[model samples]
Target: MEILLWIIIIGLFITSFVALFFPVLPSVFAIWGGFIIYHFFLNSGELTTFFWISMVTLTAVLLLADVFTGSLAVKQFGGSKLGGRVAAISVIIGAFVYPPFGILALPFIAVIIVEYWQQEDFLSALRAAIGTLIGFLSGRLAEGIIQLIMIGWFFLIIWS
Candidate 1:
């Protein structure tokens, strides 16, 4: 039973990673949900209430991060709102097509095309595309760091 729950957590972790590559999905909270399951079922023997509260808190933080990370990055990096919207749509499309890399490429391509169409300036379009690329990359990096921390917490709970 514990092993089964652990396996589910592992699966969620993998899904979260896959989500990170896709633009529309939020990876951090998904993995955080997996953590909630793991802590509540597998390794949550000693402090059930504490684990639940912690899980909720973590979920809230990750949710906020997911919501604002990209938009904030876009503006900070000089991408226009329209270009960001295009990139976001591309992300959803990418998810249905292929995995990982396919998803990652969507925003980059979408921003480039749409920015060029809207601005008619090759250099400006390129800058917008670059901004989206950097934002996505940085967001993914943050997701990865969260995953690592969750992994560490998971191991600590199960092994210790």
Candidate 2:
């Protein structure tokens, strides 16, 4: 039973990493699931209040990062608000359309199309598309790093 539970927890942690690429998966929730399993099933009293608080804080940061990074990038590149929203929606759609490549290409294409349609300026649309790509990549990097930190903290707590 203990080994099985450990496997499940580890699987959830791995899934969290996978979620970095596929936005459909709830990355933070997967990590929290592992922690929650450890707390409820393996050792109820193992996780301290500090652990929970820190995790919650980090989760909030991740959420904020997700919401702002891409939109801010679009705005910085002179994209309209609609461009930012299109980029965000395309990212989710891209994940399922063709996987990793789709994740990269779809947002760029969508942002370009929408921006061009709205502004009727090819160069400006291209710039917004580039910004969308940069923002998506940046957000992914940030998420990956933060998730690593969260997992590392979990291990530190458990193994120490």
Number of the top TM-score candidate: 2
lDDT of each: 0.70, 0.92
Highest lDDT scorer: 2
Return the lDDT, model 1, position 47. Answer: 37
Candidate 1: RMSD to truth: 2.9
* Tens digits of per-residue lDDT for model 2, 60-113: 999899789899999999899999999999989999999978888998999999
How high is the lDDT of residue 10 in model 1?
A: 81
Expressed as tens digits, the lDDT of each residue in 67-152 for candidate 1 is: 56766766776678988887767767877777666656778878878877877888788878777777667766776776677656
> Any residue pairs clashing in model 2, and if so which?
none
How close to the true structure is residue 141 of candidate 1, measured as C-alpha lDDT? 76
